[model samples]
Target: MKKLALYLGLVILMFLTSCSSSKKMSSVMKTYEVETMGVGNDGTYLIKVTDYFRTSDEMVYLDGLKRDAVHCVIYSGIPAGNGSINQPALMNADTKIEGYEQALNEFFEQKEYLNFINSVVNSSKTITRLKDSKEYRISAVISVNKDELRKYLIDKKIIKSLDFIF
Candidate 1:
């Protein structure tokens, strides 16, 4: 009877552990929110992105935020807000393109996205600590060269050229 009870307790403990791990994984995979802050001169878009991360390092935090902003612009359109019109995503998320994932992985892993970022307004950075968690919610406004990024993608054949529809 004692052995059976011990086994049952062990099973419950394992279940609880699994549940917590899954929660952590889900949070890590969660998407950050991006909104349009304004438009910049010379085909640039000013966007605000909010993201949560466990690290408190400023450089790491800023890098993640910048990457998220570019990701949102390419895959998830920046929502219309703060006197800016809605900007549609450059690549259709629903569309499946062969080699696109490989190209995207290389683009980010190689930090190629940095080329399109005009600047990150350090003065606009905001950080908020989450209650009962080590995670911090950080937000920043960044200027991205939209036209240049689009042209780059087209050149890499990751996205179709504007003249393709002609």
Candidate 2:
């Protein structure tokens, strides 16, 4: 009778230990919140994609075609109180948009965060071009699997329709 009781106690202990370990298993899902805005063909969009990381302290940029990673999360697009859309441009000229090529070069320097952000589809630079008496700002942040993105573009038929005008 004592031996049977000991075996039962051991079984109970193992069950409790298994339950505790199961509770400690972590979650596997990731989520990214993306937002985009376009104005006057010169407006810029700020996209924030947060995964398991809770803080928005860093952002990663990748060249659209080359797919190289860039570090520095300088432009998180956290809204400035109840300000207007042009708030990003309200800063000093030094803080304003750099020429496309210059911005591209600077962005390429931050390659350390690439593995975390696999690819970026839209251009990273805050580009300003005049069109029809209006200036447009175009920028984006994309957080997703690189392979999934290319496949998505192809599946949606958007990839086949565009020709590089640049």
Candidate 3:
């Protein structure tokens, strides 16, 4: 029937769009730089995250920076610098995030990352336009509640508990 064929076409189109969007999100997640600034009180970390964006909108830029900060803590870990030692990623580098894709997508989409952010030093913010491009390079030092984030990930079963032994 024509109706059945149309429904199938729509379903397939939606599936393809969703797949592409997920891939785009994951790729973007891997594209930020994090530098350890210092350790904050109560298991928190103060780090500077830098990322490029096509828009200069304040809200979008801030959100992107926050997301990058959390993503780095979760996946890439912060490099040693500014009197802070290296911190390993909560998730192992060899671990593929695809298994936890849905949970992470929801975590980010629902703005749950905001919960782990203690503060953003707006005075430390810097923005510069890339040469001959529309993209802006933005950087800021943010305080993240690393302990709380790790506990949440463990509770969600996205990562193992601190006592898990190989």
Candidate 4:
């Protein structure tokens, strides 16, 4: 009986913690909303992705051993009024676009954040760019292809045709 009570209490505490964390995140985001300049000619969009992580995690990632941090994947596709659009941009681009190489420089030339990481996909070429400010202690590399994004967008009606040419 005592064990059962303890288990219930733990579950309740976990539920409340998760709920409060989400609410706290909302408030933090309100204060630090992403700044979007606009989309590029090839449907590539630029926005700063920010997250509010636990202070402990922030200290570890921002001050510890994470020097060359990889980046996270795209969270949502582009948006239009009254609805969402499949205006997806791949993180990996095989064709480099002018005025877009700034991301690479930006990636290397930034610091003094809770945590900052910029991803570059310049092996073949690149048309998309992204920089992330995470409040969590997570590491990853997200590779994507334009063809795959197009197929998914078309199949899901995010775009009209594969060559819709955003």
Candidate 5:
């Protein structure tokens, strides 16, 4: 009986802690919600993807570059109005876009910007399209590895290397 009571108290404390932390964090960061729509050959291997950025951030362009509000995309082939028979693809941010590498490097390299996106990405939920058969309809906030993200951006030349000389 004592053990059971102790375990229940611990569980309640953990639950309250998590709920409060999430609420507090949400209040601190500006929220950006993304709903993805994608097209490609057969919708199996997406050739083009559209990430709709829903945020309070000003979507503007300055200094000859795009505003950091949302990301623009480029596609390998024209959307055939419907998926092709090529093969099915997963609905992920894996498609290659025009100038995306450069944009990603410029945008996510900054600590503040990275943190902003990190918060957004980790907090925002993933929605799916019913028309796409392979869609997973996963609607949950997920966290990511910053180191892996940085390395991927660097490898794709979206950002500069950290190597420096005195």
Candidate 6:
């Protein structure tokens, strides 16, 4: 009985030591939100995306065009007519407009912007179509990587790399 108790105590002590000595791995995470606007054109819709930077209290403008950043490529496309939307081939001025909105959303949502900068990102996209025309307007807002932006500015001498850790 005494030997059994001793072995049990030893096992408990070993378990306690291992648990206390274990190390936690360090990691990084990013969160984001989005807002959107829609314009109707010939039963179709045009949407734009914009990212939100800091709260209204913080810096109102980022690099340019308010505090949010714009994307250079379109993120998605939807067709028009019959109130239905589809990602059809790019054609006409309306298609060009959609492309711009998509690009802006993509650029701001990039992990490099949010994860590296360690900023909570929010974005929006809206579309509005003319009442009696075949035209639609799209817009978007995106905010991410504020810290990365600051670091880049400080390191103006050298271009800094921006990317998500995970």
What TM-score, to 2 decimals, does candidate 2 have? Answer: 0.20
Candidate 2 lDDT by residue in tens digits, 31-147: 323333222122232333322222222242123312221112222232332232433311122333334334334334543224335435444534344455343333445443334
Candidate closest to the true structure, highest TM-score: 1
What is the lDDT, from 0 to 100, of the residue 73 in candidate 3? 88
- Candidate 5, 1-166: lDDT as tens digits: 9999999999999999998886433112322222222332221222222233322132311110111222211111222333333321111244333565446445545432333222223234344444535432333322222344445555665544556311
CA RMSD of each candidate after superposition: 5.5, 18.4, 8.6, 15.2, 14.3, 17.0
Tell me the lDDT of candidate 4. 0.35
Better structure of 2 and 4 per TM-score: 4
Give the C-alpha miss distance for residue 55 in model 3, angstroms. 1.7
Off by over 4 Å in 4: 1-32, 55-150, 155-166
- How many clashes (backbone N, Cα, C below 3 Å) per candidate? 0, 7, 0, 3, 5, 39
Question: How much lDDT does candidate 5 score?
Answer: 0.34
TM-score of each: 0.79, 0.20, 0.78, 0.24, 0.23, 0.22
Model 3 segments more than 4 A misplaced: 1-29, 93-98
lDDT of 4 by residue, 1-166 (tens): 9999999999999999998887432111222223233343242333333323344343443332222211222223333322323343333333223443344345334632113323322232211223363344332221223344344434443334634355
- lDDT against true structure, model 2: 0.35
How do these models rank on TM-score, best leading?
A: 1, 3, 4, 5, 6, 2
Candidate 1 lDDT (Cα, whole model)? 0.84
Best candidate per lDDT, number? 3
| lDDT for position 21 in model 5 | 83
Is candidate 3 or 5 superior in TM-score?
3
Cα-based lDDT at residue 50, candidate 4? 35
Model 3 superposed RMSD (Cα): 8.6
Per-candidate local distance difference test: 0.84, 0.35, 0.86, 0.35, 0.34, 0.35
Ten-residue region with minimum lDDT total, candidate 6: 67-76
Clashing pairs in 4: 53-135, 93-125, 94-125
Model 1: residues with Cα > 4 Å off, grouped in runs: 1-30, 93-97
